[model samples]
Target: MDWTALWLSMRLAAWTVAILLPISVLMGRFLAYRQFRAKGMVEALVMLPLVLPPTVFGFYLLVAFGRNSPVGDLWQGLFGHQLVFSFEGLVVASVIFNLPFAVQPAQRGFEAIPVEVREAASCCGMSPLASLWKVELPLAWPGLMTAMVLTFAHTLGEFGIVLMVGGSIPGETKTIAISIYDKVQGFDDRSAGIMSAVLVAISLFTIALTYWLSARMGRRLS
Candidate 1:
């Protein structure tokens, strides 16, 4: 068992979830409430990753984050290091790759809120921000949990994007999925099986727990 790789995957998933939570909430709320031009286009763009091939998406990200690109150059100049093959790079890639998993559920949750409830919140003198923090969030808690779990699990299993962006740098960018691949390629079937089993168990538990909790919460609410 590669403890370093296991820890790194956990850290990456945790960081991705942390960064995405507030962003998902804001974007979800905006999409839920706003009627704007190209709304369908905007949604399609947000959802593109879900349908796009991971390697193809990763190839573009590789070019965009390579040393020659403006954003890449700026980051290197300021931070004194390139972003590629780094843990930070993995986090960024994971966040982008798993964004829809976090945002779509949250958006649906927000949309599920009744118009009457929002109107009542306004009538009770709650500002939009206040209502979001108090009323909207409470009602949408289950969806938010689903978003976080999905993102975490998705990040845990990422291979293509993380590999393209971060490469396999142990203790830095090598995640469990990559580690499993490496082990298998090296004919280390026992190690690969162990890691693969761990991933499967974790994913199964998270998905099962998420649905169970959602069902329990629904029953309570009803």
Candidate 2:
């Protein structure tokens, strides 16, 4: 197995979760509590990545972040390097691509909060921020945890977008998934098999843990 690549994938997953967690919380809480125009449209946009093919999404991202594009140019000016084919580019792509996974569960969790509970929080003179931290987050822990796990797992497994945006540069952007592809292309079945098995094990563990948390914490909340 490519240890370096495996490490890179973990790093990428960590960065994605760290970046996406708060965004998911804020957006998910808003969508859960607020009603406004084009709400369905906004929710649909968030869910778009779930159905969109990875390669297609990656292609659009490639163009959007390419050297000639405004985003790319601005990033280049600010960072002194092209955005595409870099590790930072991969993290940005992973966060965007994993939006639904992180947001949907969080939204559900926030929505599950009882109106009376919130009213009571306000009655007790808790600020919105304090209510979010002390009341809402504890109640919504399971969903938030699920979102974080899903984002981390998806980032580890993501292939097409990672490849398109951040090409296989070892120790930089060559994540484990890309490393597995490289191993296979090079006819190194043994290494590929090892890497695939590792991923499968991690995925199973995360998924099962998600279900467990949802069940156990969900029951306590009830």
Candidate 3:
């Protein structure tokens, strides 16, 4: 097992979760509370990654972030390196690829908050943000927790997108999933099995913990 790849995968997942949590909260709240034009289209766009093939999505990302593209050129000029095949690039890809896993649950959570509670918060002169922070979030803790767990876990198992965007660069962009693929291709079945088992164990533990916490939060809310 490549410890560096394991560490990189953890780092990528952590960064993806950290960046998306607040963004998911905001997007989820908006979709839950707002009734705007093109809402369905926006929601569909947000969910596109969930349904789209990961490699296809990563191909677009590669183009968008490649040195030939405008964004890539600008990024390169400013940062002195292309975004493609970098750790930062991996984070960006992970965030996009796992966005729906984070956003959908959070949106559902926000929607579950009773209108009366929000009205009460309003009556008490709390701002919208304050109401969300104090009332809706407390009531919808389960959904938020689910989003975080799903996002982290989804990122851990990512393969096609990470491979397309970052390739397999040990300690730089090679994640555990990529490492596992490499091990298997190299005929290192023992290492591949060990890494695969570790991922399965981690994923199972995360899912179980999420469910347990969600159930507890539901009881508390009730």
The best candidate in terms of lDDT: 2
Give lDDT tens digits, candidate 2, residues 1-222: 999998899999999999999999999999999999989999999999999999999999999999999999999999999899999999999999999999999999899899899989989999999999999999878879989999999999999889888988999899999999999999999999999999999889988988997798878877
Clashes of each: 0, 0, 0
lDDT of each: 0.91, 0.93, 0.92
lDDT (10s digit) by residue, model 1, range 5-48: 99999999999999999989988888988899988998898899
Per TM-score, what order, best first? 3, 1, 2
RMSD (Cα, Å) of model 2? 1.4
Name the lDDT value of residue 144 in candidate 3.
Answer: 86
Worst lDDT 10-window in candidate 2: 213-222
Tell me the TM-score of model 2: 0.95
Model 2 residue runs over 4 Å out of place are 212-216, 219-222
Judge candidate 1 at residue 61 and give its lDDT: 89
The stretch of ten residues in a row with the least summed lDDT in candidate 1 is 138-147
| Best-fitting candidate, scored by TM-score | 3
Better of 1 and 3 by lDDT: 3
Candidate numbers, best lDDT first, in rank order: 2, 3, 1
Candidate 3 local lDDT, residue 9: 94
**Model 3 poorest 10 in a row by lDDT:** 213-222
What candidate 1 gets wrong by more than 4 Å, as runs, is: none
- Per-candidate TM-scores read 0.96, 0.95, 0.97
User: Which candidate do you rate higher for lDDT, 1 or 2?
Assistant: 2
